[model samples]
Target: MVSTPLPPADEKAVWVRSMFDRIAPRYDRFNDLLSAGVHRRWRARTIDALAPTGGETFLDLCAGTMDLAVAISERAPGARVAAADFSIRMLASGREKAAATPGPVHPVAADALALPFPDAAFDGCTIGFGLRNLADYSQGLAEMQRVLAPGGRLVVLEFTTPPGKVFRALYHGYFHHVLPRAGALVSHDSAAARYLPESVKAFPDVRSLARLLREAGFDRVRYRYLTGGIAALHHGVRP
Candidate 1:
């Protein structure tokens, strides 16, 4: 499979936000179709990694549509889950979804790099499928570490390039070609789907990501690759 080059730095975030806004209506549906419903399981695993206790203040960064936030609320009923996103449209959709759920999630519009919160404000944080879009992913990771209290856990779930030679070839083909086409057909935004593959290719992988987390002042940094390395859940502590 031919690798598609990453988009330039200046245009990447703008393109990603625009694409997400365009696909916001069908976002959940597209995710279900794209990942064959496995994203739900991945989210469950991510929430499990965080292991939120009741009554803790949890922050879900880049909480696109609040999937992770809702999952956290369900898993830890007494926990207060706050969802933050830079895109107003995405936050609006997430708020609407949260309104229907049993547990209430506070939705806030905020940037990932410069989170609007006091230091060490949250007990735990989770970000799913949203880190790749940040202009400075390292800075975003640092902000996540900053907002967490001492010993607070940070969980990040993201797509990654598969490792096996044959499977990697097949995955790349599907990611770059088939996914874009199907996503365009379903969401009516080809650029958004195209951006997905590009962003994954550009984002740091598990090993490098763990290093970045440590650099951002996190300790006990570790990651588990899921689905044969096509995705990963990275964890760290704010020590």
Candidate 2:
């Protein structure tokens, strides 16, 4: 299936940025339809995992419309949160919603592979459902490590296939079939909907991702399956 290219490389960046720009208007609705409102719950769970304490600074990489950034703001009303993404339209969409949260939620246009901020600039890092689309997950992880202060925590929430054969079969069917159709109907962007599952299907497993995190200079790397292994959350601390 033909779909939007991945990011960082010039062509892929252009394709991804354009795709997200087109979908920015429908993204929230698209997500609601794609996950049947469960994505919100998953995001809420991710914020809990992020464990934002008031007054701390956090960065949301690949922030995509700022769902998690808003969650972080609401959860820790005094925290300063920066939501970074390469898609200008997506960042604009997020900026429109920033007023709802008590704390500051700044939408910054930045790529994950080469973040624009200084080293050790944030107290925590959070990325949700966005890691798979990075040009190189390892480089992205390293960038995350670079921006986080020593002992800063990084939390990642992403879709993953189930391990059990029977469950994997059912999950693959939904990912390849039902989800894309639902996504297309909501976003009216069939190529992106098709790319969603295809990209995630090609991504590294949760265990491999944990190793990559460790190799990228993060300590205490660990992961846990969510939603019967349909998604996973990985957490680590900067060394």
Candidate 3:
């Protein structure tokens, strides 16, 4: 199913920020409800792909409530993980999760399109389910690449359209119809929750996204389908 065209770039960014702010308080909980907590499994795989060693500085763009940041600190205790998001409310929520992290995971209020970090400042970067919400997906990918040191890996975990006809049909129906309602029930906001499936439907397929990553100056771009392509983990190295 196709979604209506997105608004102008500036307008869409403002809308997405406000939408995330409105739901920040319960965002993590609603995520569990929507994915039945299986997102943790996908994220674990993403961390493994990231393979953060000691003393590296990494970023979690579109970090939301900082689940990945916390996990990164847990997995690589000496790594410095910074979670950056446009939503201040989401950053505030992320701060709470930092207390439990093994290493320091700082929250930064930053935009992905124009990241505040210097070029090649980070050892690695990860964007979890947040790339699709960007008004300009390709630009966002490039910006992530610009922030990473040459040869540093970039891992992106995101929602994707399933490739199989039978699975796609079933997943599409549940995503648009069931998932939104389930999210609304969890967060008490239907419209923002409804935007979830709309964004996913509008995102490019796995192959297209891989090509976009390569075009964005990332080499050796590859993707692995998760849960039958209901989501995917895409990885690349900065060149």
Candidate 4:
């Protein structure tokens, strides 16, 4: 299969939105196959790190399918969740689940780099498997920090390069080879399938991502690898 080229710098956001729009119908299904349903555990870890409280506002940025947002609402029954993402189709795919949540989970079509919400608007924010798609990771982190209230936490659940060399090699082989083919077959969008591994390869590893979180003006930044380092959950507090 021909590899899908990463989007040009000037068009990254637009390209990402379009790509996700095409795959929104199968996004959740493909995610289950790719991670073997392990993404749910990773998202559970994100909620644990955030330890959200009742009556607080949360922003599930890049909240494709509203999985994390719905979970957060379930956890904090009195909280409000803004399921924000640039791809409207992606958001639409999960509207029913979001609506069924005991707490409110409002779908908001917005870009990650430039959020429409006011500063310090959220008590917590979470992004699951979505940050690396951004045109600028730094700007994304900064924007996350900007919308969070002081002392509010940001939890990021993302694919990361593993630390152990042997495991890393095996992980890469599957990610670069097996995942793309399976993704293509299931999603019927080969370019989007190929883009997954390519994007994860270009994304920062656990430590580097932690550093970026710190540099983004977040305090108490820390990360924990999950499932043999196939993915990671990083959390930080806005000061």
- Clash count, candidate 4: 0
Ordered from best to worst TM-score, the candidate numbers read: 4, 3, 1, 2
Q: What clash count goes with each model?
A: 0, 0, 0, 0
Runs in model 4 with CA error above 4 Å? Answer: none
- Window of ten residues with lowest summed lDDT in model 4: 1-10
- lDDT tens readout by residue for model 4, 1-239: 56777888789988889999999999999999888998888888889888988899999999999999999999999999999999999999998898899998999999999999999999999999899999999999999999999998999999888889999999888899999999999998998999998898888888889999999999998888998888899999999
- RMSD vs true structure, all candidates: 1.7, 1.9, 1.7, 1.0
For model 2, how does the per-residue alpha-carbon lDDT over 99-155 read when each residue is reduced to its tens digit? Answer: 778999988989888899999999999999888877678888999999999999999
Per-residue alpha-carbon lDDT of model 1 for 1-239, expressed as tens digits? 34445668777677667777877878989999999999999999999999987889999999989999989898888889899987778877767668866566899888888999999999999999988888888889989988999999999999988878999999888888899889888888776767788778878878898899999999999999899888999999999
- In candidate 4, the residue pairs with backbone N, CA or C atoms under 3 Å apart (3 or more residues apart, or in different chains) clash, namely none
Candidate 1 Cα misplacement greater than 4 A, ranges: 1-7
* Residue-level lDDT for 83 in candidate 3: 94
TM-score of each: 0.95, 0.94, 0.96, 0.97
TM-score, model 1 to reference: 0.95
Which candidate number would show the highest lDDT if scored against the true structure? 4
**Clashes by residue pair, model 1:** none
